[model samples]
Target: MRGLSVGLAGLAALGWAASALAQDVRPNVLVVLVDDAAFMDFGAYGGEARTPVIDALAARGALFVQHRTTPLCAPSRAMLLTGLDAHQAGVATIPEVIPPEHVGQPGYTLALEPGVMTMASRLQAVGYQTVMAGKWHLGSGPGDLPDAHGFERSFALDASGADNWEQKTYMPFYATAPWFEDGQPASLPDDFYSSEFLVDQLMDYLGETPGADRPFFAYLAFQAIHIPIQVDPAYTDRYVETYAEGWDVLRGQRRDRAAALGFIPEAAPLAPTPDRLRPWASLTADQRDLYTRSMAVNAGMLEAMDHHLGRLVDYLQAAGALENTVILVTSDNGPEPSHPVGEPGFRLWMALHDIEWRTETLGERGTTAFIGPEWAFAAASPFDLFKFYASDGGLRVPLIAAGPGIASGIRIDSPTSVADIAPTVMQLAGAEGAVADFTGRSLAEALSGGAPAVYGADDVIGFEVSGNAALIRGEWKLVRNLDPWGDGRWRLFNIALDPGETTDRSQSDPEMFTEMRAAYALWAADVGVLEMPDGYSVHRQISINALQRQLAQYGLLPGVFALVLLGGLGLGGYWLVRRMRRRRHP
Candidate 1:
């Protein structure tokens, strides 16, 4: 009896200590980010972009087709890091001015604001070794740098975004332009892809993982598929020939697939934006060749990256941490608005972008602008409009969660958002999700097939980029220009029914529009939407001046060429295998 008592007492004591320790131990989290791709682009979601590794994972995990996020790159990454919407972060617009003030308010800026909690800081507080490798678009100055925040080790762009995705970056945000590693002035080959370097470092880091017993939190943001897109020439031939169809044929095909998948009620009739194209017939074969190569380079980069993702998973499985570690793969945003900038990639292009009415594609002479609506509509998938707009097609992203507790091959219809990612991640790690509560809920139940729903009916979601805004409340969504110039431009859509915001019901149901607008006002007050500057904030000459200085610094001749170059695609990240990228049929 005495021995039994001692044994029981010891076991009970150990249990108590473990319970306390578990609270202090944060799970090793791996948040994988895919740049610029959409949910429909994946095999899991039912579209045709090939990502086998991600698909295999999804076959045994949960996929959120309705996951919403900002359609632009920097803002989306910022939102993902902080779990706060854009306004609170003070990153409403992609600044033509990389103001020094926007750097970390402390060392960890939650959208350039104080008191905001980052996933890194939150995980770090509970004993996580937060590490960020690749795109850290939140802010990158003194305290705002990844190191200043919770990330103990950091390898990312120098500022809110990167300069060049290829071996070089023209932007100051990089350690010193032309790409540097971990803030060190390192020299890389001109052809060395930033993504390859990022993945090499990530694998090197994962390669160092001693065991499943010691957990890590890794944020792998790969800046691929973003503009100046480049890839290993080995796979160049495959895509170069594929993209030769030019703009019109490609857009038509994308529409057909989107409709077949039921993402769109019916693919809206193809409406090419005039003054926006080089009419396929008008362009000589040589012109077509160059244009086609520009896009092929971008697509090939995605394909190559997808293959690398397969290898990364192979490494994980070989290391014996495959099933235990949690993996969530998603994109920062969907396809960018194919709107032409003056140049293929430059800052001056952005100033021209604010012109509001001049929708020109890049490659023109003085008037040369962006690629415009034709390509934007094709790539955005089942929705109208691309980056910077408050539309479903613009915000809806692909989300996949696989590992221990999550079920495979599931399509979760719940309207989740990027904010939900952190909580879902924390919950599945089997750790106490007790700290730094957020606007998101644990989707573990849904991922595991134990629960039918994820969040609640009242779970509201909002996204903003450069003043364009959108808010989701249940089935109805309101995408309006908020308060002041607040035309309420009231666009109401049953997102559940029309994931594509093509059919406008504002006129059909004025009452619903008003209700949604009112609801937005109330919600904005709660979340605190930043007050917009009254009157027309865009000044072409002044905007051009600010942009001019930025261009000169980057070695570009100012004006339209800069805009086109800057029109690069939505930036992507590195978080998971290839399967999470596929889109679905309706």
Candidate 2:
């Protein structure tokens, strides 16, 4: 008996030694997150953007056709980093659209709560050098920046978005573009462009620890294609005529291309264009030119982002780190539909800030532009609607994974969520023990071709933010979107057969709808999802919040003016009353 025990102990020690050695050679991780890119926005995904770098990655990596994320930015970001639901990570929704009743609530805190462990923190615990660059909208309160959330060296913008060409607020919601490096306020250079600066900062961080034996977990969150989209004219000039055909024709082209690529069924019906948008032919020539120029700029911004990303890839190759690095590229949500130019009082604000919206310089510095809803709908071809809704078009986006241990030239059609990203990264980095702490399952097997799918047919997943809700169970999806885009009712669709969500199966498949609806109710209760107040609209709430923030920032002068105007009126009224009384007495 004593001899047998001694042999078992010896085997256990050998296993531990083997694990330690394997951990020492774990692959470096590079997670690239783009803001508000649609499912078909990248060239590899059948869009007009000249994204050679990202396309090359897709060519040699796995591209996910059914990946879903929250419809909003901050919530999706929270899920991507923590491998948990948006609520579990303490960012139920973005501050810009958060309702007043839900503020400061348990899940709606808009910041990472205590005890939440991020991917960077977990990787750093196991000897990985973690760094980050670009947008960090997770939080802005005390200890809410990237440095406090496991990033070692970070140049993070702690807002929804800011000017791409300078350190200024893009919208009236912010007083300034709050940027920080290593937890201290950082300033930008005179020639700063967002995409270039973000990549430059990441390279500097990587170069600081040259030839280090330890691996790295670098997160590059680009603000490309977000609001105030700006890029060099050199990139924009190539696409000046690409969108002249307008959004309706572009929508059909994308849908056909998506079918050819096997992203959807050949017979899948395209979602009807919303009644709110005018037909392309009805628009005046000037309007068409402006819209066309805006889309060209959108493509240019994406291409510029790709060009800069290639620089980082080149740097990694030169340093011999590319061979053993795992690169995952994805977007936070679908394309943005908001057009600030059309909003009331927006022109005045633009003029006040020296922002121009001319066609000739659409994507240059000092210009603010967006693709708006029509183009956003076109960009999200073969699917319904765009961002800020729970429809597939808003939640479904592209995900590409490449590098060591990941199979090349693979396309994964299985349904996956952004929450699954952190666990997969941890698993690849040899931090498997920490994977159990997250709600998201690892996609390591799927990426390695060990399994065709991650979740079984019985598995259920639920997502909600600012009243936009969706639940998935196998081939069925239950979605409820409120206000502007949706009628505030639950609709069921078989996503496997209809990725476009053109047909509602609630009445046709009653049993499945009932079962899924009940399952969603249970999941929502378990997750502590708060019901939105009656008559709530995210768009309305955003305007309210923006106005409140603007008032708080620059209200004193306006307040004084209003007070002075009221005082003069009061004095005039009193004098008139006194004169009327004297006349009556006389």
Candidate 3:
């Protein structure tokens, strides 16, 4: 027994030595994930929000103008981390928007399945310390938290979103914030703000192994700019009058700015505004004020997040780790479009929770604020639509990478997918063996000024979530978005010429369109893409899911109320029958 113990100690010491050697040669990686930020929502990308830190990051690194992700958050996250399609990563759709018919069917399980490896896991296997802080809407099942997925330390929120100031659910989809630290339930601090707390937690984790030569992979997923877009009044004050021109004018302004910034073609026609949006001049004065305040709040929330990010960067620089760290900043998807205040039963739910929706306190604590679809369209700018669809407006977002071995002040316009992120990180970390196992190709060469682009013109990539689908082949894109915003028919566009998707080339280029459709069909089958049910609408599905979750959370009280109402109705009918019979006899 003594001999065995000695052998174990010797092995442990050798393992430590290997890890130390690996750390000495490799650089640290920091991934900053913003929630529901649009393609042009950063100051570097010509957005109204003042994001100086991110803008600086862009100035010093490669900015990808044609990068796209899955149209929803969880799926984009899964793909971003795994280098796989959303289905392959085991999160085809989020719980809030998934239909009942699709539950528990293979990739629709909504959790990372067995044998799937995240970037954290891959990096950890190579002796890198992995830590994560912020929203982790991945899964809550056993072995599904960040700890099980190779994060050495994690403070994760396992819900779509929650109040920024308190430990409460943002919508009826969840009962609580559902925060966890290292897989154990946790609570927020007394003076909690989402962005500040998330950064603080990450800094704490990074400090745990201070001066230790072990390379670290830090994932900071901010909940900023998502629904319930709350920020300090100080930040909100900066944008109060910025969006007063309203969405229509804002949309045109953004499109023009995008062209000026070289993000799109100079003559790219603007996509038509969504029909559901009312003309800004036609709205009541009160309505305009409310909406303007809400947009201001959204911008403020993003700026606040950027401010906190600057803090983390400063911390790393002060710790002498910034010089060797590779930083990647991006959003999960396009801007959020849902307005909980207008959703059925949401007002009552807010009332029960003492939440306010007044314009006077739009971005303050205890108030729920959102930009809704009109602002979402403007935020997306030169693109066709926003989140929950396959439109570029939903999928195309900002991606900036700066660090060792990356080119400075370069913009790569070659189409790139979120799945490419994991492989790129792996290559940068010198973990090349695992890159082959992933479906995504590495962009390390492009970032390092070696290659012009990552994907060749002939390469095909596909995306699908909740029935919305798109196929990208070189410069041409074939997309089919579900109803309410789209006709469910496939349309072809030369995205290189019209990034705004202003013209449909399906009729003009029949042969290419048919070929791309066939390619998409093959890709979908290869990726285990499930067919959505007839007339499947993401909005309707969300409503259905919310009702189901609400019933599950507070079923007993509602059930009792329903029974009492039925009982009272039965009694009233009996009384009426007796009175009528008595009158007839008399």
Name model 2 segments beyond 4 Å from true. Answer: 1-23, 557-586
Prediction RMSDs, each to the true structure: 11.9, 11.1, 9.1
Q: Per-model C-alpha lDDT, please?
A: 0.57, 0.85, 0.85
Instruction: Tell how far residue 38 is off in model 3, in angstroms.
Output: 0.4
Q: Estimate the TM-score of every prediction.
A: 0.76, 0.91, 0.91
**Candidate 2 structure quality by residue, lDDT tens digits, 196-283:** 8888788777655332556889999999989988898888888879999999999999999999999999999999998877678988
Query: What is candidate 1's local distance difference test score?
Result: 0.57
lDDT-wise, the better of 1 and 2 is 2
Runs of candidate 1 exceeding 4 Å displacement:
1-27, 46-48, 97-112, 160-167, 170-191, 209-213, 262-282, 338-373, 432-434, 481-488, 535-586
Question: Over the stretch 532-557, how does candidate 1's per-residue lDDT look in tens digits?
Answer: 44443322222433445446555665
Candidate 2 differs from the real structure by a C-alpha RMSD in angstroms, to one decimal, of 11.1
